[model samples]
Target: MFFSKLSYTLGLCCLAAGTILQNGQVRTTNYPDIKIDVASYRFRTYDANATEISYKGRWDSKKVSWWSAPGLVFGFTGDTVAITFGDLTTDTTLVGYRIGGMDWSFTNVSAGATHLFVSSATPGVHETWPFNPLPFELRVTNWAYGVQIAQVHVAEGESLVRIPPHQRTIEFIGDSLSAGMYTSFEGLSSFAYGVGAGLGDTEYYVTAYPGICVSDQNCWGNPRGQAHQWFYTSDTSWRASTIWGDAPEPWDFERQETTPDIVVINLGTNDNNSANNVSTATYVDAYTKLIQGIHGKYPKAQVIVMQLWMGFYASGNSYAQNQGYEQELKDIVAYFNSDEYLSAPLVWDGATNTTTKLDAPSEPFVSYFSTRGIMQHNDIGPAWHPTDVGAIKVASHLSQFIKLTFGWELVATGPEIFHETLYWNDEQNY
Candidate 1:
């Protein structure tokens, strides 16, 4: 299901210019540090008049709290605080924030309406609240360069420190599908977060550049610059040797150290077009060389070659023509496997229909719908990045595969485990 309007509220005491808000009190610090801010709103629904809110959990327990408001400021605080919401006679919205404890709960929130939650993290765990069966959108930002602590649901007595950061990190590289183009808030729910949460030991990153082909040689040159512009930052550049000879320098692929334990490359869809119909043989050779180049940099990284979803061609075409191109790409993976130098295997199991059409009412395709409805599309954030939901689905799929392939134990609670099971079934349908 998709939500139209949702709100999140966090009771916070803001500090004077450049001050910090902590323990429900505003204080100033000597050095510059990062903080989280939160904001929530209550939407009017049919049952709004009678909705109730309550907080349940151990008081003073060390836990992560999130907050968001206008602008992009978000923060987390650690202190004992009480949360209250609800109208005595009718349902009203109640919102508050806790400095650093869990022991809290809100009850009788109006059903059937989605709610939005936004939170940020500086150097600690950053999370968005109202996570279960989310009925609204969630936006999270991490400003602190250092990694922070963040978890969706904490066990009854477990502390935040006890939960470990994801062990395996997977990076997705490709165009819109891999970037999650044309998705909605609900679709974002199925994104990498959910997948990481499911695997219990994996983190996922989407480095997809919309409309970018596998080789720069095929890109529109000069003024247009192709979609490659989306992938490169002022600090980092991605030049496939098959197109630009040696790797482009001055740009830092090393500092972008967002490198993954596993890298899934899903480009080439755009490269298979009319102007760039370099024979499948030539494309495979180039793609294989590209894989070798990545391996040269990250020898331990596993590379997965992905196929197109549904939009590679026009709506009416049955996708037969592209299927052959896809097979040749698979052959490239086989060639790499034959080489003793490349130890990592290419993953090709999660291909499915594009999330764009699945969201439409006319689709009637519930069986394969990602947990958040659409699977691989981004609703917001960078032009074609996966929306939160789409990222969750990819993360979930990759996480499960990593866990099973690497024999990692599942650490999430029973309910979360079940959620992964449901997601797995949906992937099977694909």
Candidate 2:
């Protein structure tokens, strides 16, 4: 494998003034260096560590704590650091960086195993990007393919301190659109993260997988091929009726360090699969149950069920399927808006229907972007996925909805960025 010389820089060098805080210690650091165990609070998730060979040599005990899950975030208070990656055989392995929750950039693998230098540090200091060190979160949002980390390299005198978790958290649950599939933009989660950053301290969590559906049965034939599996592993293999909750086997919400203040559900793109052919009644019932389940888990959360975007659906002939998919979403939203409580107990099977229909207020809590025909593909990657510009447009509308609904301050939009094209190669196809 060879390294590609593809680099881009943004912003000027400046210093952000703030007192550092990490794990209840107010101690100051003058050493200019600190080694953080990946398992510490420095990393967002507490249970995503995986054993891997480190920058030192072998996979020793201490260094084996590298993060293995995609979107396993790590926050940094400093300006720059070197990230080490494991064996990458595909060009799809990517890392996304958001600075001060506004500026965004991505690093894709061009070499087998190597260290990538990322910084907003002042220029001329050891060949770093000359921007000031601001609060930043780096996420491997597209690691559905395999990618691993060994260690984070910082100056020998600086400390890798942990910033406290965001006060208000937003959770985005969906399919490829939410997974950052072909979008360089960080999907709805990043948009929410940016908006929440403006409103005191806020963070966002993502539970998205590519090609998954809410239909009880999909073309994949996995009985558990529903969108709720996000509460479980992104792994599409582990199927069971009782595999989600506050327990450690999959998604133990009680064990999760953060809970969302707002939850956004953007699905139905895959549910409209022409090959799978999910019935309208099946679609609506499955969607209703999913929303009810989310409400049951996070009662206080402001749940926003979104309309599905127009992707390149099933050889471009699934428009009717998509329309039906969208109507089911509207019916569910109307049902909830009409009553705070369900008229009947939610049935897991597609049998029960709630007799509540209310006009949806065209405001913050509701998203009608797809209905407005706003999410057109940027004509970049596969016709199926969105480009960076497209993702930004999606985020912009959602952010506006959040601002209007909660009266929260909104952050400025991030720079328009594009990820390298990803191709599935068997005979070298694009």
Model 1: worst 10 consecutive residues (lDDT sum): 7-16
Model 2's alpha-carbon lDDT is 0.45
| TM of each candidate vs. truth | 0.42, 0.60
Candidate 1 local lDDT, 190-293, one digit each (tens) = 34334433554444554443344555453322111122322332101121222223432222345432456766666565566555444655556546555645
- What lDDT score belongs to each candidate, Candidate 1 first? 0.33, 0.45
Of candidate 2, the 10-residue stretch with the lowest lDDT total is: 7-16
Cα lDDT of model 2 by residue, 355-411, tens digit:
333233212233333434555433223435555555556666777777887665654
Query: What local lDDT does model 2 show for residue 429?
Result: 54
Which residue pairs come into collision in candidate 2? 31-157, 32-157, 32-158, 33-156, 33-157, 33-158, 120-131, 123-130
Reference-based lDDT, residue 111, model 2: 25
Q: Show model 1 residue runs off by greater than 4 Å.
A: 1-165, 186-197, 218-259, 275-282, 311-324, 340-399, 408-430
| Error at 1, model 1, angstroms | 24
